[model samples]
Target chain A: MGTPLPRDPIADAQRNWERHGWGDVAAPMAAITAIMRTQQILLARIETVLKPFGLTFARYELLALLSFARSGALPMNKASALLQVHPTSVTNAVDRLEKAGLVARSPHPTDGRTTLIELTAEGRTLAKKATAALNSEVFGNSGFGADDVDHLIRVLGTFRRDAGDFTEE
Target chain B: MGTPLPRDPIADAQRNWERHGWGDVAAPMAAITAIMRTQQILLARIETVLKPFGLTFARYELLALLSFARSGALPMNKASALLQVHPTSVTNAVDRLEKAGLVARSPHPTDGRTTLIELTAEGRTLAKKATAALNSEVFGNSGFGADDVDHLIRVLGTFRRDAGDFTEE
Candidate 1:
């Protein structure tokens, strides 16, 4: 790398907060800021790995979602809901994926007004290869050991639960 | 809210991965995806709290940074570096903050080619008030107990450190 990425800025900010007599707020600020920066770093890394496959993380997610569908296809509306994204985003992803010859759109078999997204043979093959690449390069070695990974999920899960992401038993 | 935000989609996706015989990747994917979604949720919450102050989270961050400066001013390049963002983003943030009367720009006192960003009196006042609002409304109630917050920071810190966010001690 030309220049190494600098040390965490939030750490410096936290010190600054303490100096300014705002130590009470520093912990939460540092936590949130780190989460945001970590997201950026992870996305950048994933995108880099997907670049050679002509996929951004978003596109890769769409392909992977399609690949996971039991019928190898899903209604656009269902895709939108399942992906937890807006309808326009799903539509846009499909448009680009279709242009890339990785997926196709057709009228839903049982619903006249519904559109269905189905993967092409090329799309299926690409999805598998991309998955393998991501597994080895990004997912498999995200720098967190298995215990750390489990802890992260549990910690973040608490926030998600409180935000109404799901009701706890 | 008309309907509470639905359960975290990533959790559902993780389950789908297991059902599809990709359980091996589910743990890492869940951890990463939950982190990504949590970032979005936190940003949205922060933005909402900052809305009444006529600030987005990015603008609020700039104000807070200036407020924390020992000299109450910083060079633009320094702001970019400390903020861990591109120079163009610093320029953009300063431009918006200036337009909002929260900050002012001037030539550096001793450096001919450097520009300095200083918080206006109004900016200082707003920064404090905004900090208070965020502290009580958003940051203070981020859904993580103190222990969980500490745990999240430690776990995410590991990833950040390994990703070259900072050098190890």
Candidate 2:
């Protein structure tokens, strides 16, 4: 990482927004921008942990999701929905994983039009190892304090729900 | 966006973690995953606003940064540092902006070894328009509530500070 800046760049950007007569939206702008930066920080950390396992965060998420499935498989569209990623992204991840012998695509038994993505034995093993590493190296020591972690989950949960990510039951 | 899921996927993932004997790390895992999902949601909104201007968030950030510079220019390295992105990413943004006639690069006047990136008039104008659109469509009505906005700013500020993004005075 570069040396810590003398000041928060987002704060400077917020000041610039205010100076430009955007006082009304400056805080939201800074908050949104902070989320972008924080995602970058967290993704970098997560990716580092997953790298040795030959996974990007996207691919790892797919593997982890499958690993949690009772049948160790899901229809492509269902996986896409659960992952909140585009179908094309799921397709691409499946392609990579299949090439790496971590997953396979098979015709859905009950639906000819659907394809099921099944985690291979190797995929399950890798997912377990990767999760263990992430649990220990990243999540177990996530940078946010305990209260901040709870706060983030609640706040971002609200934001996500507002964005139509899910409906609260 | 896809149809709203029946439940929060991150919450489901946290439960899965807890069931797997990762109870201690489950909350942090969910928090981080929520952040990842939140960033995706916000970025999609931001990108839609930026799309008509032929700008991505990265390029918009560079244009906005240079527009705020007193000279409408900054050394390329300094721009990267201030933006907290890698120098290669700054270079890539510069390449696209230059091709679009939005920014130009020149040898630094006093520092022969440094390259300076300056916003062209077009870049400045586009940045203004893009910022106005984002302010109106996204920032002004950010999915976050007003109180949540302030909370995000403070909470994320602490996280960023701890991550070495800045040294407060």
Candidate 3:
């Protein structure tokens, strides 16, 4: 529906690799490039979707995580681990969410050295609305149908597992 | 070999989604999250490989691009387009590469407004060696064998095309 992509640089790179007698090495190069480029494009689309909600994907993820919690709260360290980002990034996202009145930080009830993050009522409401919007507008419409999406997840899961992203359970 | 990935947060997110009556939306969320996390892992691996060469993936890409050029030179605009990065990113990368003495800029022979970036002899030599190193280490040794690598590129290519990353050729 949008303007078609202008060119395929990965394919061009592959051709160049072949011409240079490096044909065997071309696939990985193109694959990595495509993965990187796709991340960029997806991030941009996500940013555009989240802009109206006054949230970035990082903050949105934090809010969503809290909303999903049984107590609507999580320790900062737990949040960091769950989000698969560094503590500093978690701290930064929490700071932004707090400033936006979507999240609050409190001392963990039992842990002397831990801080817990909770979603405010406003945050909960926003998270719900934002999730719905994203589901319909971005995630649900990601172009790949259910079958392709499943295949992508399966293959990428293997790639991630091999990269030590997570132990296969 | 490295510390195994502890757990897949994306999978947890999917379970949450299913429990929250958003089951249908789980696939895209997991897929995008996997893509993003995989990119992070790949970048980390790439960074490790490039560190010895005093290069980051961004700088390596610029050098590799110039190395692929017939004249070992290309305009900044062209580099930006080919790399699928912004002009400022190109400028920053070029600035760093120039300071590293791996790249040099010269005025375009006929176009006053265009500047050509060329790999110095040192740059060219390093590019060659680095390419070889990456081929044997990170890129070539990426867990996916040739078949899986090709399959990844094909599927991701379709995804990117649908995302409007490039016009179908």
Candidate 4:
């Protein structure tokens, strides 16, 4: 949804160190620290915006999963694995989504202790709308052209895969 | 510093939907949601590891910034801008970094209202050690290699400059 940083030539590197708490550190560390700091700043802004919609990143993730499904449904256990969260977290998230009327949980056809969570039509519609708004609200401000956005996705995708993201276990 | 995500891709998608409220979203929207999710997961994991050290991402960021600066000193305004936070967040972050004996603040040179902050040697040394540990924690898990770490950094770096960052007034 956004692009890279420092719209202006960045201020002094040494000054950045003092500000971010690296205080006279090297360039690499300074750069990393700055990234982390900016990351927090951006996420906080996104969080506040999503708050009014009753959506957290966690909830949004769940909805995305269901919408992508061919039948718009998946088993609870299956969803839990993909999110990399504990079963309990998945349970809680699903409960909230269900309450919001964004997803429906039905008895699993084949698995015990697992339910099938699917997006209702209304849920699907909301997800579509929110997706656009989320894009505009979070990254749209950057005024990224198609290529910039595409590059960001490809890079982030590589990053995610490289960051020791868990495979199905 | 990330927890293992479930192997189930379906649940993973569902998690996005539930948390972000997305359904039938475009690749761009899905991509942004995924990036945001990973950041949270990574930060949470980082917080867990750093907890025993009495540090958070914010603290680590400050320490690293200071460690990179000249004699570990810099002015206040730059800190706010580099960290991409309100001046107040910088103020509070420094207050904590100072109280922790990681940083110190002094009167700004020739400026009555401004201040300068610097990291102590203890902070600098500690930052190095903590970073080493952090690197291992990041690398030693999830069956990822240094190449993967490098790739991840590259991708994240792409986003770092690609855009979507908000500016402060």
Candidate 5:
């Protein structure tokens, strides 16, 4: 804890240079690299638009997921896993979602460290509106059909599948 | 900065909540919802593995782009535009890359605000190896293939285009 991060150039550089080789660094950085950069640019562009709806992307996601969920809900752990974050983060997100009245948390009834989250009535109404709005923005009027989407999901799933966690080979 | 950020409750919660909802928070944060979330998670994982390399995703990206360029170089502003980062951020990234001996800079013949970047021999050599390794990790016999990748990219592009970024849509 003394050092927030390593400082030994001689010692740490080798360790830091672990697997992210020159080859990977040289590639399209987009095709195989992370999507955060592209998204960050877009996110900033979209913020002003979302302002009128009183929704942040996260809240919208919570509402969207809950609305799409089979039971209109999910356990805390499931949500966390689905969202790809640590359990603690899910706990915090759910807590906020609860406060916003977009979602509610209940005892797991199964696991102690787990909680169940479901959308509130208000949450559902807002989520639907948001989803529709989101859908429109993503596709525009070109009207690329469901088949295109299915194919895309399939391919991307592969991209993600092969990529794994981005750390392990 | 007038304010580190605005006192927007909705925006704040969205930013925090996104740590979970978007599926991964491993990348740097940005206001764009989909792009940022995707970037954060993928970058997070890649960077985690890359920590041993003493490189941030930023530095890695610089290497990758230069390696991919036919001339083994690009202008600072071109790089910034391509990466969706500010010109200053591009300058900072280049400084780090130059120090690492992975890339070099030359004054632009055309633009004063621009600097040309080229990968070093060592940097070029290293980048090739890293990309192969990363390709293996992402699609590495993952039971997903080119068809899958094609489908996925199309879908994601569609989604991003349709969604118009995370913040507004």
Candidate 6:
């Protein structure tokens, strides 16, 4: 949004926090802010790669998840749980995907109370193409070094589990 | 958003990537996905603490930045640069803050064309209250332990630098 500053703003904020006598929480504050900023950067990169496919990260994620599912389908709640997002969000994404003819909602045959979100043939194709683009353009050249990627996966894995995102198998 | 899954969805996504022969990019994919998820969790926590103060994270950041300035005011461009957000976003935040009587805008004293965003008395008090609450509720009990926090700060500092967010001083 502007020219790079000579120093990191988050680090400066950490110093300010310490100077204000909130030293105990300063580090975590900086860490959290950094995560926020980093996510912004990475999401920009990801959305750029996905844009040609007309997918936002959230929608791309749903398509990718469905493409990987056993029958190219998941119950709406199941998709929401696996994505760690609200069910309403899944419903919104499905609505958009359905409108675009990428996916369809159907009554679960045996479990009449449940709805299944199934990828359309077009959805499966788009998912594969969008994924290849992300793999090549974003993930393959993700800013972190290999070791840093490993460290982040481990550290944030613990953080997510602690946040009750999931339990170990 | 639902019951915690039996396994981390990100790790499962990594397996899916690998199975699809995206082996080289899988780790970074998982890492990036984890960061996205972590940001969501942390933002939810931060916003919960901020809501009572009538601030979202973006507004709180601007107010907090103004509160830290030498005279509780900064040129609009300066605030935008420091916040690493688009100037348009700064304009929007300033618009809301001014409407709420939390901040005011004035022509820059020395620069005829520049605008300054200054925290009002109410803004300063609100900022302090918000910071204290965040320090207590979110930062103090941040899910990451001290070591993880340190690691995150370092790793993300490097990532930010690599992304051209800033240069080391």
RMSD of each: 2.7, 1.2, 2.3, 7.1, 13.1, 1.4
True contacts kept of 2: 0.90
Q: Which candidate would rank higher by TM-score, 1 or 4? A: 1
Which candidate gets the maximum lDDT versus the true structure? 2
Fnat per candidate, as a fraction, reads 0.56, 0.90, 0.69, 0.18, 0.10, 0.92
Candidate 4: global Cα-lDDT?
Answer: 0.62
Q: Summarize candidate 5's per-residue lDDT along A7-38 as a digit string, tens digits.
A: 21111222223434433222233333323433
Report the CA-based lDDT of candidate 5 relative to the real structure. Answer: 0.54
True contacts kept of 4: 0.18
- Give the CAPRI rating of model 5: incorrect
Q: What shift in Å separates residue A111 of candidate 4 from its native position after superposition?
A: 6.9
**Per-residue lDDT of candidate 5, residues B38-114 (tens digit):** 45546666676566666777877677667656677898876765554677888898898788898889988877876
Q: Write one digit per residue (lDDT tens) for candidate 1, span B49-144.
A: 999999988888889889888899999887776666678988898899999999999999788999999999999999999988988897777777
Instruction: List model 4 lDDT by residue over B27-81, tens digit each.
Output: 4454555456556556676787778788887787667666666656878776666
Residue-by-residue lDDT tens digits, candidate 2, A43-86: 99999999999999999999999999998789999999999999
DockQ, candidate 6, comes to 0.84
**TM-score for candidate 5, residues paired by index:** 0.56
Ten-residue region with minimum lDDT total, candidate 4 chain A: A1-10
**What does the lDDT read for residue B131 in candidate 6?**
93
lDDT of 6 by residue, A1-169 (tens): 5678999999999999999999999999999999999999999999999988899999999999999899878999999999988889999999999999999999999998899999999999999899999999999999888998999999899989988888894
lDDT of each: 0.83, 0.93, 0.85, 0.62, 0.54, 0.92
* TM-score of decoy 3: 0.93
Residue-level lDDT of model 3, residues B1-169, one tens digit each, is: 2345577678888888888888888899888888888888888888899999999999999999999898779999888888878889999999999998999999999999999999999999999888888888877778776776877788789888776667866
- Alpha-carbon deviation at A12 in model 1, angstroms: 3.0
Best by TM-score: 2
Docking class of 4: incorrect
Q: Is candidate 2 or candidate 3 better by lDDT?
A: 2
Alpha-carbon TM-score of each model against the true structure: 0.89, 0.97, 0.93, 0.59, 0.56, 0.96
Give the per-residue lDDT of model 4 (tens digit) for A125-155: 8777665666667645533345645654555
